[model samples]
Target chain A: MVVGLAAGFAPAAVADAYLDMIEAETEKIAGPLPTVVDGEAGAESEEDAGFQEFLAYLKEESLGSYTFFEKLTPAQRSEVFERHKQGASLEQIREIIMERFLKR
Target chain B: MRNCVGMILGLACLMQPVWAEEVKVGEADSEFAVKLTEDTDYLHVVHQGKSVKVQRVQDPNYELRGYFAKTGRKCPPFCLQPMHADPAVTSVGEVEVLEFMENELRDGQGFLIDARTPSWFQKGTIPGSINMPFTVLSKGEDDPEMAAALEQFGAKRRGPVGAMTKTLEGWGLFEAEQKTAAWDFTEAKQLLLWCNGPACGQSPRAVRGLLEVGYPADKLFYYRGGMQIWQLFGLTTVIPDA
Candidate 1:
């Protein structure tokens, strides 16, 4: 009877041991889970919000040139916003962006 | 009063021919009158919210000049492209393009795409054609710009696909020709894409890039002759803002 009980328990114990070994191997391979700091996450979201606002402004005021402006790199887009802040009209911004593309 | 009368007579004489000499397509008195075809007199399309009449120069002496008129270009980049970008993508000529403008384009069922870079496109493009640069289209579907372009071309994102769905697609149980893992092109617009000319690779590359992303082959048409041939035949071109 003792041998019979031992046999059933032995398979269950072996299975648990195999599972434990697999979990350990997987953890070793994957390393630590990345922790997202609150500050970094907040900064990314803030930048995204700013970009979305700029896109909305472009869509509303410069619908004709919006597609071209949307293709600008982040740096280029910043320059365009700076120009706008400095009193450049949408048409002037478009021409400036177009000149840059034409030079390319 | 005598001097005023004489001035009025001179002005009338100048205006007479201006009103009388207005020549309609296929009705020019000169033997050099140009016609698109025996049936087609001219094509009319809308460009930048204005109606544009596309017709050849009536002057028999008119010659193609400037960049398009050149016979040769450096080979490596400007080498002639094949008749077909892909076997499945139909190649079209000027007549078919005109017909497309009259029917599909006018009906909003198709798009005439100028697939050159902005530098080339800004110079001028075929009337009624909108610029969708090859660079933008060839960036792969995963790119945000490319995804936006695909959306503009009437493709919808399918989001992520499950393994079971993928297996069904692989087994031909799903309609796969108009779909990719990323995009559903079931309602994609018919695109007639052109670039510089027969030697231009821009449109062909754009077509191939679209095909790689599983855009329906039937929806893509390549105009291999492009701007060069379009000009050789004296079709109309329009500068975007000019």
Candidate 2:
């Protein structure tokens, strides 16, 4: 499945370049967490917001075909891993494309 | 408004497919569109009709529960609870374990459930426990065995509650046999629901389902340490004949 996704998103030769772009962008936002929301748990606000931004980029960039982390620019992969570590919802991330992410 | 228009356009742009990939996780009906991340532990399982995202922590041994925590965002906000809303079954000490043993397979205390598929039940199950699969309990009269079982339980073709009870009763699943599984809290006493063991949550869900059906909650107990505990203690188990 991973290989299939990689091929569809970026031919093997250019996949590396595509991944590099994602990684760079991911690193930029991850470096600085968003402002903490009042009455919210510590770090969650910033963490969630950062993740949302990264998700938006992935969605707008048409990342549905990307395979594992290899399809992402190194920066993009970093952002995803970073957000996941902070416990972002994978469902919300998927909603960026499938358009079926239920808010309930 | 331009903003609304832009928003719609933005969403449309996002929907454009970069590539299509097939990713199947667990027993889901179909593959889901996914973008994997290193920190995430599961894969998305999607059936175009509906999708349930799962985390594949134990790849070869993955079950839907492991991904429950990941799919919280898709559920109604009210349903989301802290991951550790309830203490781990293993962590609850003996004291906290109000009742941990079953007496007669029929009268046991804690819980003695059969967690396997009902097909497995046709093969056999411990004397007590009602069949409640962790994945999904096949509902509707469409299921012949389930239908026949509920019929035996005196399940009149009423509604959801009646059908659910019939299913349980048909399987002979009651904390203390129908004569005892009553609403009168005093009658409930210490009852447990089980299907398999610590790894299975069917019993817990069954207990919760019962509570929703208006069963007394306090008297209700969850033998989280299910079949595992039963087997460890060297209790009796029965196999059903086809």
Candidate 3:
């Protein structure tokens, strides 16, 4: 489903760059995160204000990457956060997020 | 006569293990002095002028059926949940649930939620639990029930409790916040939620939906054992008047 959305704007190659940019920028805020345990990122960040900082980046970041976040409902976005909390990587988050919003 | 006395003492000693007294712990301040917690464990809840005990039922005749007995559910929809719904969320057993009831429910600082439908809830439920079906959180694409439930659970909207926001892609979400949404943690209440059991996706789904809507995992407690385990422990359940 997200692949279809990826096709709408940037080609698969461009979406890859966008995904990479989002990951690199995210790692800058909270170091390199595991793809599977990314849910821990959301899990640990509830009390930490730092998670909010990273979340704001997803909301305001101009890149096409994570822009699909805008299309997602709070519940859907939370699914992305939960995946990260559960150990999903940034790329995995993007894939998961795409699958969530684009498919629906 | 001395040997006869010794023989009687030996017989009494042999019977000790067979008829031991049930040890009770914790203090309940109501009418009766009920020991709710383990002797060293110490768990109790205060209500009105009485410190009521939160405990499992001691009845030996309790049995499980219906929702608690349904074990053949499908995943992707009815999957077995991980102990932690999220990184911060804690999976609670009957003891912690009772503790939460004493601490949060008593003071009105929290909720003991039964994540079952009204029909099931009407049949019977834990002493202090309220009904909230998972479908409320998982209904249609534009779920108004979920939005209201979130607000009722003490989650204030990023804008107004139910305001709409534009997704980056330009598809509008009715009340689903994406960019500017934030859950006000200060005003939020602690929630202890449960459904039929681990296999019952109702509570887990509701919790995940709440998490999806930015409910803090810590403020949310999953009673993974739910009614199935609750019944297994012979906990008290009352039929809702409704």
- Scanning candidate 3 chain B in windows of ten residues, the lowest lDDT window is B40-49
B1-242, model 3: which lDDT tens digit per residue? 22335777877676665334555433453322322444412222322222222345433343544444456554434467777666677888977887786567755678788887676565556766778776676543236787677678776655544322334314534423322244444467888889767766668767877777666666889998887777665554554444
All candidates: TM-score: 0.59, 0.27, 0.49
DockQ class, candidate 3: incorrect
lDDT of model 1 at position B76: 56
Residues A1-104 of candidate 1 have per-residue lDDT tens digits of: 99999997996686456334423322231311121112222112215445577668878987867787767544445445555544567788789667544432
**Candidate 1 global CA lDDT score:** 0.72
TM-score of 1: 0.59
lDDT tens digits, residue span B83-128, model 2: 2213422223212332232122212223333444565443333333
Sorted by lDDT (best first), the order is 1, 3, 2
Q: Give the distance in Å from residue A23's predicted Cα in candidate 2 to where it truly belongs.
A: 40
> Residues B125-242, candidate 1, lDDT per residue (tens digit)?
7867898987788777899999998999889999789999899889876787678878988888999999878888889988998888888999999999998888887777776763
RMSD after Cα superposition, model 1: 21.5
Which ten residues in a row are the worst by lDDT in model 1 chain B? Answer: B23-32
- State which candidate has the highest TM-score: 1
Lowest summed lDDT across 10 adjacent residues in model 2 chain B is found at B45-54
TM-score on B-chain, cand. 1:
0.83
Best by lDDT: 1
